[model samples]
Target: MGMGTTTIESAEVKAAVASLREKAPFVYGLTNYVAANLSANVLLALGAGPAIGSAPGWTGAFPAGAGAVWINGAALMSSVTPEALDEAAATAHRAGTPWVLDPVAIGAGAAEYDAILGALLKHKPSIIRGNASEIAALAGGAGGSGVDSTLDSSEVIDIIKGLATRLDAVVAVSGEVDYLCDSAGRATAVRGGDARMPQVTGTGCSLGALSAAFCAVVDPFTAAAAAHAAFAAAGERAGRRASGTGSFAVAFVDELSDL
Candidate 1:
């Protein structure tokens, strides 16, 4: 379904977040080692079941049973072969299941991961969420350092839009403002998150995970919006209650659970 000009409101996003409790969806993640724990925790906080699996045989069967699937290219492993990921992503694509792709530190990783990421790009993902540098690299632009963006998200809107057009997916660029854009000319910005968010290790990846979880119940466009909106809300509240990154992470997760 084309999103067209749809702009999601915070109230609607909160409702979608609440719906997760009733749906109790399972969001499968073939994610990086670093993001895996926080991603799973974030899903649990949002009342969704999370399964982080990179086992060889799970490629086909995991997404078949999952409400949504998330593919994160953060940490490449010897066991989680690129071929296995290809099969898993293909399974989700063929099944018409919603999935999110978080291309973490795309260029900083081992050289082989570049090929793996390129291979997965052929498959259509429901959404792609990444920092400006990551998104730029995905669009054949220059990449930045590991997980640290050289360019601001706002600086790469055109690149992201073009990539979203070519990939037939909603692209979400995370920064001071989160922009969700699709080829259909639909774009929206979500604001109101704490500056301390970047200090946390898994915040961006967790958002991608939450996007996948939301996709199980809603369309990709709304899923992106809802994920950012929910994060913005919880992060703002968490920042008010906590002192720094450590306490903020705990409070953030707690706020999500309360929401």
Candidate 2:
């Protein structure tokens, strides 16, 4: 893939933010227990409604009606079953609802986890967001240690583009300089977040939820770029105001609300 490079302008991101607030789309999230609170808070702070549940009955009904959906790979480690996720993804696909996939720790975990993620791909997610290691592993490289990425986003530009094309989805790799690629091979780089972002748990998972919110109102490429831009800007602001990791986490949500 001959990837064309681009940057997401502040105006485009602002428009996405404004539209998201106005629409306040309901987002269904199938995230793990560890990240659920932060994920829901992030969505709410962004002015999007968030509904999270693992019950098979609820999963069966919610995705079809929600404006967008988010599926985190870690959810499978808990109460969420692969069958339930498949039902949700299938329902969202049938309803024409855009969804985001966060393939967390994909290559670093048991083969069963990887198998679950692989099956989710068949439903055609609108956007796939993860750290470099997760994305690289999904693209057939050695994954990182757990959720921490050993490879940087810059190291896997071509791989990211290829994955985007193969999945027919916008793929966003989170890192110091976030990278985004659409199915058409259009690539974008968003750079601005604070280094302390990784110190806070659930930041990446929350980002996947935010991406789903943006996807409800914009094209997948634009939506993915906008979400990254939003996080970059907010994280920078929160980092400046925070005293520690805990404070930074609180300030991050506040900054997102202000955005």
The candidate 2 region of ten consecutive residues with least summed lDDT is 1-10
Off by over 4 Å in 1: 1-9, 77-79
TM-score of each: 0.93, 0.96
Model 1, C-alpha of 70: deviation from truth (Å):
0.1
RMSD of each: 2.6, 1.6
* Decoy 2 TM-score against native: 0.96
What value of lDDT does candidate 1 attain over all alpha carbons?
0.84
Best candidate (score: TM-score)? 2
Top-scoring candidate (lDDT): 2
Candidate 1 per-residue lDDT, tens place, 217-253, comes to 9888878888888888888889998987999999999
Lowest summed-lDDT stretch of 10 residues in model 1? Answer: 1-10
Taking the tens digit of each residue's C-alpha lDDT, what string does model 2 give over 1-259? 4443333346778799999999999999998999999999999998999998889688879998899999998998778999888899989998999999999999996888898898889999999999999999998888788999999889988888889889999999988888898888678788888988988888899999999999999898888988888888889899898999999999999989998
